[model samples]
Target: MANEDRPRSKLLTRLHLGTDEPLEVVPFLDDTGHGVFATRAPSRPNRIGLSIVRLAGIDGARLSFEGNDMVDGTPVLDIKPYVPAFDVRHTERIGWFAERLGQLRGKLSDGRMR
Candidate 1:
């Protein structure tokens, strides 16, 4: 099928239903598909993987996500895949974020990232 004719894939926006209370998305800093922060603390945090979401194979991708912005196990409302063919840019900078990646990796591995 042609690109325009092909059906657009929709990401499954699942709420972390295994809880007493409901949580929603909290916008933070990042061009990456609107980072979702934790609205409230949960007994057991979990990740709601969006169909478009992917673990950044880049050196520091995970660290950025694991930073203080997102708490353990938050339900993401949406995700849009970064189509490198279109999203890639000739110029890009790691910014101040590169520094925090190490700390993020430590905390994030404990019990985060879906």
Candidate 2:
């Protein structure tokens, strides 16, 4: 095996859910490629959260996803990369979330990157 076949960079991630949530990834089944998972339920169906966050900085990461929250049962799945040229959609028109994209600069843990 060669180093080139290995991942150039890697991510250390953790996905979380609240106490009221009822679900489990159990050996993390049905995982597609790689993504985040909230191991608990939500206050609303859409309220996802991070119990802890960290990013490996050797690749050009702008921020490490961490801080302001902590709990033991959180389940983090996978981590990817940030590529501005390939990731940003400059020409696309925004709907209701148009103004909200800026808030995404602080949001991560995987499922929202694309």
Candidate 3:
């Protein structure tokens, strides 16, 4: 956890479901498959991950937080203060995730890749 008071910290980490192998690219941009880059699935070439969470509280060395996506014991690669100017974006198309928006509320990690 960070030493300073960063109420909104975005955790950059190496996702547990990712692998150390090279990523094979799909043939063409017009391909209809679920391209690796298009989805936020845990698998990636470099295994880097990101999660924006709210800091609930802080004491000596422990931290209380909310909106944690990664599992317990997830290794954090970096922590940066989220600046709206650089991070926020206005877009209408959210791709495949938009179709699943209604199903997210009760969704739970199935631990399939891990």
Candidate 4:
């Protein structure tokens, strides 16, 4: 929240970006190295929330989307288009997650950020 709080800026359009979790700092306090950066945890040191929901439609000021993983009233902070050429990477090695890849399919957020 800013002192000159206003509506979502027009600069952000048809983009996917970060928001503010606003509820807690560091969703998983006991998490090891790199903290929230190591995981897709909602709450982080900067309170920046991120989602890659599809931009379904835009009616004036209203934006309709699908596949949202966040809750209601999440404050958007920034936005940018999902450019596959710049974003996608074919990598087999991911730090810390290399060994935990098998568990991802069954894993779920347990409200640690709330």
TM-score attained by model 1: 0.25
lDDT of all predictions: 0.38, 0.37, 0.69, 0.51
Cand. 4 TM to true fold: 0.56
lDDT of 2 by residue, 1-114 (tens): 343333332333343442333333221222322211423223323444433233323346343333423344444444555444555567576443454456556554444212
CA deviation > 4 Å runs, candidate 2: 1-15, 18-73, 99-114
Better of 1 and 4 by lDDT: 4
Model 3 clash pairs? none
Q: Write the per-residue lDDT of candidate 3 for residues 62-102, one digit (tens) a residue.
A: 66667777777778888888888888999999886676677
Error of 3 at 55 (Å): 1.8
Worst 10 residues of 3 by lDDT: 22-31
Candidate 3 Cα deviation (angstroms), residue 73: 0.7
Screening candidate 2 with a backbone cut-off below 3 angstroms (N, C-alpha, C), the clashing residue pairs are 14-76, 15-75, 15-76, 21-41, 53-65
Q: Model 1, residue 64: what's the lDDT?
A: 18
List the candidate 3 regions with Cα displacement exceeding 4 Å: 1-6, 20-33, 111-114
Alpha-carbon lDDT of model 2: 0.37
Off by over 4 Å in 4: 1-34, 106-108
Tell me the deviation in Å of residue 106 in model 1. 4.7
By TM-score rank, best first, the candidates go: 3, 4, 2, 1
- Candidate 4 lDDT by residue in tens digits, 1-101: 34233222212222223444443334332334444466656544554555656665679977765555566555555565665577678987776666666
